[model samples]
Target: MRVQNLVVGFGPQNDTDPVLNGVSFEVAPGECLALVGESGSGKSVTARSLLGLAGDNAWVRADELSLAGNDVRGLSEQSWRRRRGRDVGLVLQDALVSLDPLRPVGREIADSLRLHTRLGAAARHARVLEVLARVGLSDAGNSVRKRAGELSGGQRQRALIAAAIALDPPLLIADEPTTALDVTVQAQILELLTGLKRAGTGILLISHDLAVVGRIADRIAVLSEGRIVEQGPAHAILTRPEHPVTRQMLAAIPVDKPRGLRLSPRAAAPVSPAAAPFLALSDRADPVAPRNTVLEATGLVKRFTRPDGTEQLAVDGVSFRLERGTTLGIVGESGSGKTTTARLALALTRPDAGEVRVLGQPFSAASEKERRLLRPRLGAVYQDALSSFDPRLSVEQVLRDAVGGGRTGRGAASASAATAATAATAATAATASAADRLRVLALLDAVGLPQGLLGRRPLSLSGGQRQRVSIARALASGPQILICDEPVSSLDVTVQAQVLDLLDELQRNLGLSLLFISHDLGVIQHVSDQVAVMLDGRIVETGATARVFAAPEHPYTQTLLGAVPRIRF
Candidate 1:
């Protein structure tokens, strides 16, 4: 397959600003060509054009475009459909959103076979099992019958890969396949892709993660804006990058970086000494003495019954304490009980056993009334900020509700009100209106978003902007404890760095405690004051960030650290 001088644009207005500017690349049989770039760099757009999936408004032009010796430049929609799965396959990043949630995963795989092959239902089922096994999802007889939601993150990703490669297409396009997966699972997925390449499949890998791509890519192309800034052997580009954008990306990596230092491209200032007290060691001899523990979980255990009527332990005997103005990062693989433990900490789920204490008060066992009284002191940021908000609410309305000045389309207002300890202490009507408006704008400024966005809805915001708004919303209540769940997993590398820096800054300036959860160890190492390694529903290791990282005591912890991608600088 080859694409030379390829260019694409969306509408009449986009003609002058094409997404791809004369991009050119090639993929030989049994070789992997990695298209590396930040978000909106035209990597995905270039890949989609080859499959004729660039959408109707896309104006695609190229001096030469061919796939498997056939001209793909002017293929009709019908021709593209016939060639898509049979000639080429695509694996998207998010498996949960990519696969059918309602149908059994096996059936979804079978649909592709039915469309491209003459196999019967029985044969298709056998083929589905074959591909599922090929992708390392060989559970049991009924494994393929499980819905997408029923599978773990890794398993769901494997299912999507199986569906893509069911017929063993000649060319495969995998876009950020390991972005959200844990290190071990990410390694496994990359190994699977490696095996596919070895078997003589031409693969196009698109990603912002240079380390992951460096592991297997035979050739590399660095993209910035709408053009390929650098292209060469993987070793040449990674070791001695010539382009400034490429150098910026390499420098932004969290590996080997000191704790509390900003990882973003923007100018960074040292954490303020006047910030709230932290239990972590620091040079400041007179830093404020330790304050009371803000959150504590003791022997937390949570259980759920699966659809098969079998018991499943999501979290087991997990214990951790978070001090005032510090970050405790929880790192683990998918289905390792990270999210379950987070839910228990948030008091969103009552543990079957054990308990949680918030601000030195019993929280897990707290009644609805008591929980409401304590709500205002806690806030959360999720991985998907757009989904976290109501699409109908504009940014100003969202902030107003969060500030407890007006009714929110979602429960932002009620939640804020519930968290506030006293209605009497709440601002008066006139003062509330003025103060809330000012506070909303202040929050926006603090998050690095312009006040002009106040009139726009979430759908109109970019991913980075939406995440900033989510952080702003979480801050509106002035919560002492903030919980972040895979908050930066889906962001581009540069954006991820920016958000991490922002969170670190916020923690310092506000003296807020953070419960940061993620699968990326590098990210954990960058922002955490302390680290807790969780596996199979237990904390395998816990200590100060520097201590635990310097010499990991647990096997799981060591293995996780080993799997983190690093350049040989």
Candidate 2:
């Protein structure tokens, strides 16, 4: 398991130099070698080049690249396929997309075994179950036939790990494997990986999270702009870093401290006090609408039955709402009905019992078609935008599709065209100049993204860049209310602050209402007008954001707030 003089990237496009220069690295048996860098620094390209899977568009070159002493640069596709699962296992960033949507997760794991082993069907099944149990996916025996879509994010990640290690590969390459998970689940995945390392499986870990890497890696390589700036023991690199980039990263991590809120993490690097606040919820000069009687619910219930004959109540008699143009932040652990409540408001899902209304309209009862008509009234943004965007479509197409530019034929063009012509006669909304280009520019600028990135596809952008595009797209509809489901969960702290500030600006300038959902209590406190603490599918405490923080009325809220790791100076 070693590589030297390994390099990979796209060829010259209109005369630009190589995307990845001659990058080199190595990983020894039973050791964890970490590669750290920002997006497009060739972190993923180097990873893909190891298995000869970088694709036709990429030009791969290496002097000596060996996986178990077998030269990778010369290996044919059929030959590399044999080495991939058998000698070098890979767990990608997105477990959901990495796994086959058409196949059962268990069978995906089973397929790994069948490809590399001569074992019989029964033996293979037993082996797959064994690996799944090792990864702590309980009831592996029963979950063997479950489709990838049916599993949770953490569960899907566990399944991916199970598949990667099914053949007991000596080397494992994990690229941001825990990026999409909650902190607790992240700890669990780290524990499992560390346990495997102890049992003689060397790992090549790739991550943007320094803390996570600090906890797991024995050695670290700090990469900036596709170059390894520093390489040494993890402790030495972290506590006694010798590079400016490394120090810049350390400054970005949240440290426990006492302060009202220092510089907003939105700055590209550390900024002086003049920098903006992280997510200024107080941007509105006017007071929020009266706290009580603004939004309320009673006896709300939602339930689902699993394919394994297990019943799960996603939301049970839960009741909560928001003040007009004010943020009501919902804090809950995963599977605690946070997403369900958002869906109910957007009319994406129908509840079992209880009424849901937006400023007092029968929201939950609206038909899906009617809901689309009302869609412009309510906007949304999710945690992972790559999953939401069609990878095949360019970013321009995604926003254009959302803005009602391409659906004219199906929308009774003759009748709609007349209506548009009539309205255009009055305001010229349908005139040749009425295209949404200004709207697109305004939205992109609002989210702090340059207009130059508009032509690129979602796949070509960084995670943070992709998120900005999603925010711009959500606002493209110009909804009165926006529902954000952990929108910054996948971002670095610095990027997170930028997004939060952008949301704050939108709320202030456009008077947009926000239903902000997150597990981070600090974010909730900083941005929420009112806070609703949910636990086990119920809102245990609901009140003014400051009041709730000053004196949380519920034990669960107390516990959740207490668990928030404070920043140290």
Candidate 3:
């Protein structure tokens, strides 16, 4: 596959403002060529142009574009469709959105075979199972019957790969394929792609992660602002980078960096005193002691009923303590009970056999009325921030609602004094409304957002901006503890670096205890003072982050460390 002087624009008027401007690259047979860049840097646009999947408004122009020695410059939609599954296969990043939700996964795979090959129904069914097993889904019999939503993140990604390779296409395009996968599962996916490369298939790999690219790429091309800044062998570009953009991206990685050091350029500046006051909780007046356990769980157990009418233990005998003003990182693969343990910590889910205590008060075992007063002191940030927000509400409304919800004293007045009570209620409402507005603006400032975004909805904001708003909402309650579940997993490296630095600074200024959960071990090492390694619904290992990573005792922990991709430089 070759692309020379490729240019793609949104509309006819955007000829000079093309999304991909003069981008050129080549993928040889039995080779993997990586395209590395941040978000909106034309990586996805370039991939789409090759497959003729660029939108209707796109004006695509190239001096030379060919796949398998055949020109694909001006192919009609029907012609491109005919060549898609037979000659090229595209494995998108999000499998949950890529695959049909209502259809069985097996049927999704069979449809590709039915479209590109002349196979009977029975033969296609057999091939579906074979392909599923090939992609490491060994229990293809059960996986074939389940829908895409029923599978875990890794399983769904593997299912997407299985369908893409069912026809054995010679050219493959994978776009951010391992963005949110665990280190172990990402290693498996990388191995599968490598196997395809060894089988004489040319691959175009698009990703923002330089570590993953260094592991599999034979050649690398760095893209910035719709142009290729550098292209050469993988080793030279990673180790001895020539372009300033390449160097900046390498420096932004938080793998080996220590805590209290800034990962991004923006984080070097001092935190504003005005912003500090908004993030600080009442506990900031007291000095934080190392032994103060702010959140703790003992002998926690959670179970779920599967589709087969069998019980599955999601969390089993899990116990941990989070100290005040420190971060406790949880590392695990998908379905390892990290998320369930987080829910238990947040009191979002109840445990069947254990109890949770927040600041020496009963949390998980307490009734709703008993826990309501204490709930304002805890906040949570989820992986997908866009889904967590209300689509109809503006940024100001979201923060105001959170601030109002945290106040629990508004409804305590008696109903006996009718006229006087009504006048008092009116005055109180006016005062609270004025206070809420000020708090909302302060929350935005604490999260480093501009006041211009107050009127915009969440869907209109960028990924980084949405995450910042999510953090602002979490801080609206003046919480002493913050729970972040895969907060930066889906962001690009530069943006991820800024968010991590922000969280570090917030912890310092607010005296906040953090329960940080992620599958990326490098992030765990950078942000966590203590780390817990989980596997199969239990904590297998726990220790100081430096000690645990430097000398892992458990075999599973060792395996996980070994699988992590590293940039040699």
Candidate 4:
């Protein structure tokens, strides 16, 4: 697969600028080529343009385009349709969007085989299991029968990979496969891609994570403003990058290398011991004040009944407290119950034992009336901002409903009056009128979202902007505690830094208690004051942030820290 003088964009639109410039590169057959850039850098557009998947709105032009030595840009629509899956495979950033949620993942994988080949149902089923098992989804025969939601994040990713390779397309283009996974799972996914490269598959890996690209790609292409700035071997580009952006990229890969090369300037905020508690340290600071206690969970436990007739304990006997004005970071591996703990704390799910206390009252066991009373005290920020928000609704509507102040749709004025009537009872506790609309704008500004975004939907914004809006929505409820789960994972390092700083600033100024969850240790170290290491449905170790990171005690904790890549000067 090779791209020469390839240019793609929405073209010079009446309002918007062209999306891409003259982009050119060549990915060798059976080789891994990585395209690295920040959001809106045109990397994604370039990847999608290869198969002419950019749609009619896109004005794409390329001097030369060929896959497996066959000219692609000139193919007729019918030929392109036939050639798409059978010859070129694309793995999108969001697996849920790419794979139909209504169908089992197995049949989804088998669909391509049946469509492009003469394989019957049984043969296709057998092939699905074989390919899925090869992707490390073991005993996939039963897995193929289950719904896509039934699988874990890792399993779901493996299933998607299996589907992409099922038809054995000569070229596999994966766009940010590990964006949604944890650290360990990310390592595993990278390893899988490396193996695929060894199997002589042409892989076009597009990502903003330079560390991931450094680890996987044989060659690297740095795209900026829809144009290639630098292209070379992965080691060369990462180790001694020539382009300024490439240097920024190498410096941006999280401190995961464990050793070698000194970081330029300083990338992340200096780890602040004064911020929050973390890891295995033994200093118990006085409990943050009552108004500060936004969310607290004691002796929380959650168990799931598996299809295998066995009980899966998601969260077990967990205890944590978030006070106003601080970020409490939670770090753990996949299936280690991190997410379950988040849900338990929020009263989003029922816990088998223990109770959630929000703003100083038992929450999880609250009656319907009790919950309604405390509804305004709770707010949540999710991982994927795009799906969490309604596409049809504008940003203002989302915020209006969240703040419990307005009726935003057709009968907004009447609805607002009605909402005011029902909210009158809860209103007596706090602000009587409703949450201040000015505060909403303030939150948006704090998160770096523009005020103009109020009229636009989530789709109109970039990934970082959408995430900022989610942050704004979380802040709109005026909750004492804000639970953020991997808020920055979908963003690039620079964006992640800005968001973290914004969160920290907001934490201090607003006296907000934060329950933050993430798989990145460096981020955990920087963001948390107190840290708890959870593993296998249990808190393995909990201590002061600086102490635990300085010298971790638990073997599991040490193993995790060891897995983090480091850099040397």
lDDT scores for all predictions?
0.85, 0.74, 0.88, 0.74
Clash list (residue pairs), candidate 3? none
Predicted structure with the largest lDDT when compared to the true one: 3
Using lDDT as the measure, name the better of candidate 1 and candidate 4: 1
TM-score winner: 3
* Candidates ranked by TM-score: 3, 1, 4, 2
> By TM-score, is 1 or 3 better?
3
Listing every candidate in turn, what is its Cα RMSD in Å to the true structure after a full C-alpha superposition?
Answer: 5.2, 6.1, 3.6, 6.6
Runs in model 2 with CA error above 4 Å? Answer: 12-16, 69-71, 101-107, 118-122, 240-244, 247-294, 304-312, 321-326, 357-378, 384-441, 451-466, 473-480, 490-494, 505-513, 519-536, 540-569
Q: What is the lDDT of candidate 2?
A: 0.74
TM-score of 4: 0.80
Q: Return the TM-score for each candidate structure.
A: 0.89, 0.76, 0.93, 0.80
The digit string of per-residue lDDT tens for model 2 on 109-152 reads: 98878888999999998998899999999899877888888888
Worst 10 residues of 2 by lDDT: 270-279
Please give the lDDT score at residue 459 for candidate 3.
95
Model 3, 269-297: lDDT tens digits are: 23477666555684445343225898988
Measured with C-alpha atoms, the lDDT of residue 435 in candidate 2 is 55
**Which window of ten consecutive residues has the lowest lDDT sum in model 1?**
275-284
